[model samples]
Target: MATLPKPAAISIRTVGPFDLGRLSRLHKSCFEEAWSRSDLAHLLAMPGGFGLIARLYEGGLVAGFDAMRGVGFSLCRVVRDESELLSIGVAPTWRRRGVATSLLQASMERCRAIGAAQMFLEVAVDNHGAQRLYEEHGFERVGVRPDYYHRPNGERVAAYTMRCDLEARCGPSRGP
Candidate 1:
């Protein structure tokens, strides 16, 4: 018999080179325009690209799995600096439990630690729920990328280029 990787503990851990499966699923769950398993797997293989997941805890089952789901899909040449929130998605059953908040917090902390100056994310222009959440978390709309999202109505939806200063937004929370 082959030994298996231990099931994820119910806590935040670095979404290291491993754990791409859960991360990919979380992306599809959160975004109308989802990424493929292979697409995410390729990103993981590159350097300087970050991803994180939130796993639910039960006796032994991992419920409510989630990921930071960074939006940009890079095939190669991962740079240390750039702004892009590739994606963030939580299992539908896990909605309204602050999972998205926790995921964002974790991702920001990690980004700050790694010396990222700004983070960019494209939210559906009409997605008030997510926009409010992002605003409360310090993200501001810098511009709009028109025809940026694939709408379910088969129309192209606009997306906002929201940017948050990693250090300025996260440092104060640590202390004076």
Candidate 2:
């Protein structure tokens, strides 16, 4: 049997409007088509929008890892009782090190705190790694969107729509 790798040691924190430049740089490093600083600032400024970033530390020094570095980030929006996971990206060298998982977990906690009953996201059909991560986090495939992603080379790809029932996972609330 193959042993699963251990998750990396990191910290997650809420991202604010001031993080636009860092977020943009990280997004560019992770994706072919990246969101600009202006785009990130605008999204984060929205009423229901929020984001989280994962960072690595060692000996009390941040960004200690030469290669792994700062792990990843996640952007989400919650309105009413529903939430959408807009985007998530992990640094290439930091993939499979639990960065995305930590980000997702933190994002879910934030969403639930803000009264989100459910969360949804889309993942490219070919991205099995991301799919597995989402599944591990209780996200289920509810549908598929054909040609949902356009590649830099003009190729189109399909995406799976996944949803997670936060209320079900957390059980019933005992509050007003």
Candidate 3:
């Protein structure tokens, strides 16, 4: 068994257009297929599309070490009353930490703030770790996509579609 990295000071911030390069690098490190910088830029520029990046810091370090790099990110797009979690990635070394959870929570809050009533995401069936995280965050498996993902070696993987009812989890909004 492998040991996970120690938890460090982490800050979650909204990802902007300027984060394309960093986000692209992190995505490539985590996924078999990485999204291009242009794709990330287009999504961030689209209406109701937003993203969040988590920066990991080593405590008691120099200025550069204080903001090492982005360890995780989540991208979401809202259409009408629904929001879809388009992508989420965390570096291998940063896995098992609270980075992904924090990113999801922040994204959910943003979605609710923007009047989204529900959120949905797809996770690979083999990714039990991510599935557990999503389930812990109130997402329930609703369906499955057959052969939805392809591996670098040409193997196909199925994905589970999970959904969370924002209104139900956060309760009814009091309104502005």
Candidate 4:
């Protein structure tokens, strides 16, 4: 039904604090509730948090744009040796463009680089698409929080907590 944008030139890589504006746009675009600029800045400054962005280039033209604006991001809260995916959104215009996948991959790599042993996140009960994505990435349902997200009508949406063993996925095995 819809066509996706052409891939960017430069492969995906870790995004640092310099890309705050771009990430802010994407965060606002994707969520009814988004992280405020102060919050995002604070997160970046946090010692255990990992933030990144995707830069696309082609033919001397940054073929792609800040997917962060009105899209999704793979984020995590790294604490001690563990991490948690904070949020992710695919720009409404850029859905199915492999952007989310790229973000996830980069986030995971960041976690590993930061010495995180595991990663986890919470998704709305109705978000099957995200659930599937996480599943494909080796995440499994570890727990659930009933009536988690508050709805406009004062109702609550259940939240499913998913988790994956980062080291297990990319590091040496410690199994029988």
lDDT of 3 by residue, 103-175 (tens): 9988888888778899999999999988999999899999999999988899999999999999988666433
- lDDT per residue, candidate 2, 1-176, as tens digits? 65545444678888876677888999999999999998898888888999898886544434345433556899999988889999999878667767888899888878877788899999999999999999998999999999999999999999999999988765553322
Candidate 4 at 142: error in angstroms? Answer: 0.6
Candidate 2's displacement at residue 139, Å, is 0.8
TM-score of 2: 0.87
Colliding pairs, model 3: none
| Per-residue error (Å), model 4, residue 154 | 3.2
Models ranked on lDDT: 3, 2, 4, 1
RMSD of each: 8.6, 3.2, 2.2, 4.1
lDDT of 4 by residue, 61-174 (tens): 332454323245656778867788888776676677777777887787678667777888999999999998889888999999999898767878999999889887757423
Residue-wise C-alpha lDDT for candidate 1, range 1-176, written one tens digit per residue: 55434333335655655666666666776666677777887766667666666665544344344333222111212246544666666666566556667778777766666666677788888988889878988999999999998677899989988988877887733311
Off by over 4 Å in 2: 1-8, 60-69, 171-176
> Who wins the lDDT comparison?
3
For each candidate, give its TM-score against the true structure.
0.74, 0.87, 0.89, 0.81
**Candidate 2 pairs with clashing backbones:** none
Q: List the residue pairs that clash in candidate 1.
A: 69-87, 70-86, 70-87, 71-85, 71-86, 71-87
Considering lDDT, which of the candidate structures 2 and 4 is the better prediction for this target?
Answer: 2
